[model samples]
Target: MVNFLQRFLVFLNIYSIFADGYSFNNDEHTENIHPFIKIGSKYYFINELLKMNWFESYNYCRSYGGELASVESHEELLALQNYILARKIESRFWFDGNDLAEEGKFVSHTTGRPLIFNKWSQNNPNNVNNEDCLEVNLYNKELLMNDINCNVENIAICKYREPNTHCSGKNSLMNQNEVCILRNLVESFAQVGHRCKSCSQAFMFPTS
Candidate 1:
């Protein structure tokens, strides 16, 4: 396993250098460095600091039209990370790779190795606390496994396996969560009406 990781790392580095050149001198160039790759007809991107927990990773991915990465090898992991770095966006990101389902049996989406690159934050994976998910630090490119709590709000780098044309539509599933709010908005508009009269005559609800 170690030998495999070593070889994979070497190959990944070479690939990184080979595909690292780009020109961002203009807006067109700026938008050219997309941090994503199409593998097996599925699109994957780097987790650019998704400070989300385990379950959040699941839901967040769903909301974004993808699922947490199920990497199965070192090459794939490196490829995904390199794609992100190639963009020169941030230093690190997040991936949907974990094995909380069977604790201590750490697994990698890449290679499916029982013990792959398990670079955790200091005093991490203790599983002693709430942390169960993982995030790749953009600076040192290390992984930090953490727990998810709903109260904490962390911006996540979203990925999609397949691009949906409705992704940009305001009425798309992404915006469905706001359905109630949208209803309230429509209600408010109805109360105000198209041509407003005196407030006294506009809304004369019975005082109960």
Candidate 2:
């Protein structure tokens, strides 16, 4: 009798799902969660929270389907710098400038562009202590660039390889098979009261 009462309560809880009109979708959650900014022809993702060494930061950005941001123009660089400051991010951060491939001729492994638009500070790219990686600093009233040691830990800016801002997400039309499966699952759950909550990665927002 106790088991039967517990089962009846579970069924009531499941029925409440029908009263609330919303479906949980993992893909849709991911698609809407990134703090992506489209600048010119590219999208950039900046993170000031989890500072890492240049190599580690590079891999971190790569894991997110992008690399460090590559500046093609001074305007682009300025826009990014301004965006960073306006949000009150960390003072300095590592970016895409590096000459690991060939010393003195800095190039972005991410963008495949020679450092044609170098924004080096005066007497910069000094290669001091074999500094081959680049980091931009917004210390005091100075906005400058420096060639720093790759192992130095700092904030990171990640560039998105692709940005899809089309008509697709959770609200998009579902395929016939998917719709049928979802309907069947909904029906089964409605009859069973099996509430569930999936664990997800919890982290601070990378940007404002």
Candidate 3:
């Protein structure tokens, strides 16, 4: 596992350099460095302080081989919030948490997992004005989550497998957690598709 993590770190750094280059970020402030950051096992892609509607943000993340950022837990939420605040960004931003999948049920579009943790402010998520999207209220000291119109433009925060990463998105029945972890690990491999078959097997049945 240590060996694998070390390899993953190296690959992530190289990928970061590639993404920071002009050809890759032609329109989104090509000069800005640190396009993304890896925290724990997830890779987060932050825009050049640009604001876009939730739908646009989601699609943009997908185009780059990822999905909208998922603040699955309070710790994760606070960590990201601090990271943004540290940059002196006072703007509230978008993260994956919406009831679009099912009315009154907010789940991550990327993983289809129910929202388990939240920091919603008072009277937030009131679904006012037919709002169905989620955003982090940066100005709120408590880091409240709020429901807003999907079309409302806001800073886009995305996370998932990095761009240029390849995968089959296929895996046998196995530990869901491991699958998620491995999915991100092999994301950068062009041959990860067919390779996942064997790779998944190896994890299920280890050698030695």
Q: Which candidate is the best by TM-score?
A: 3
User: Which of the predicted structures, 1 or 3, would earn the higher TM-score when compared with the native?
Assistant: 3
Each model's C-alpha lDDT? 0.48, 0.69, 0.69
Residue clash pairs of candidate 3: none
Using TM-score, rank the candidates from best to worst.
Answer: 3, 2, 1
The local lDDT score (0 to 100) that residue 53 gets in candidate 2 is 91
What lDDT score is found at residue 47 in candidate 3? 78
| lDDT tens readout by residue for model 3, 34-145 | 5556654455888756799998998888787677887667778777867777777777788788998677788877667887787777877788898899898765555678
The lDDT of model 1 is 0.48
Error of 3 at 144 (Å): 1.9
Off by over 4 Å in 1: 1-42, 45-54, 98-103, 106-124, 138-208
TM-score of structure candidate 3: 0.59
Point out the worst 10-residue segment of candidate 1 by lDDT: 21-30
lDDT string for model 1 (18-51, tens) is 3343112322342333464464334565465555
Ten-residue region with minimum lDDT total, candidate 2: 199-208
Residue 152, model 2: Cα distance from true site in angstroms: 0.3
Off-target runs (Cα >4 Å) in candidate 3 are 1-34, 39-41, 162-208
